[model samples]
Target: MARVVVDVMLKPEILDPQGQAVQRALPRLGFDGIAIAEVRQGKRFELEVDGPVDDAALTRIQELADTFLANTVIEDFTVKVEPS
Candidate 1:
């Protein structure tokens, strides 16, 4: 089996309210030393496939990410195949 990881995140120009909220609350939570200039929340998905990883599967995964996992208009996604 092969494990595929898909990471979906907002585009740089997009606003991430949830991440921003977390960043704002960090200071109050005694994480003032964390000098994070910005924050962006994202989603990660792990998929298990029953075969050797290949370029075709990776291409399909990218298509799936573009069509279903992420909103291409506002977000970007990356697909990675993990060593079995």
Candidate 2:
């Protein structure tokens, strides 16, 4: 089996309230020593393939990412096939 990973993140111009909340709470959560300039949250998807990851499979995955996984207007995504 092979593994594929897709990472989706909001565009730089978009506001990430969830990430901001975490950042704001970090200091109160005993992470005061860590200085964070900004915080952004995203999503990760792991797909298990039954066989070798070929170009066709990657192309299909890319289509899925663009159509259903990530919102093109507000987000971007990257897909990578991991070694089995």
Candidate 3:
């Protein structure tokens, strides 16, 4: 089986409203002296499969990102695949 770890992230220049929300809450929680809470909400996924790095697997992974793992318009993702 092959195990894949995927990290999904928002673009660098894009603003993260979720992060902002957390930052705003920090001050109320007595969190001070911090410049800002740049929140990058992301996902860590573990995928188990039975195959080598074939074209079909690559295409299917991309499709997975486009279809569900990421918001195509405002997010980007990177994946690390390991053989087990």
lDDT of 2 by residue, 1-84 (tens): 999999999999999999999899999999989789888999999999888889999999999999999999999999999877
- The clash count for each model shown is 0, 0, 0
Name the candidate that leads on TM-score: 2
The order by descending lDDT is 2, 1, 3
Q: Could you tell me which 10 consecutive residues in candidate 3 have the lowest summed lDDT?
A: 35-44
Estimate, for each residue in 1-84, the C-alpha lDDT of model 1 and write its tens digit.
999999999999999999999899998999998699988899999999998778988899899999999999999999999887
Candidate 2 local lDDT, residue 48:
95
Top lDDT hit: 2
TM-score, each model?
Answer: 0.94, 0.95, 0.65
For 36-70, candidate 3 gives per-residue lDDT tens digits of 74666667778887768577897788789777998
RMSD values for the candidates in order, in angstroms, are 0.9, 0.8, 2.8
Off by over 4 Å in 3: 20-39
lDDT accuracy of residue 71 in candidate 3: 85
- Candidate 2, residue 71: Cα displacement in angstroms equals 0.9
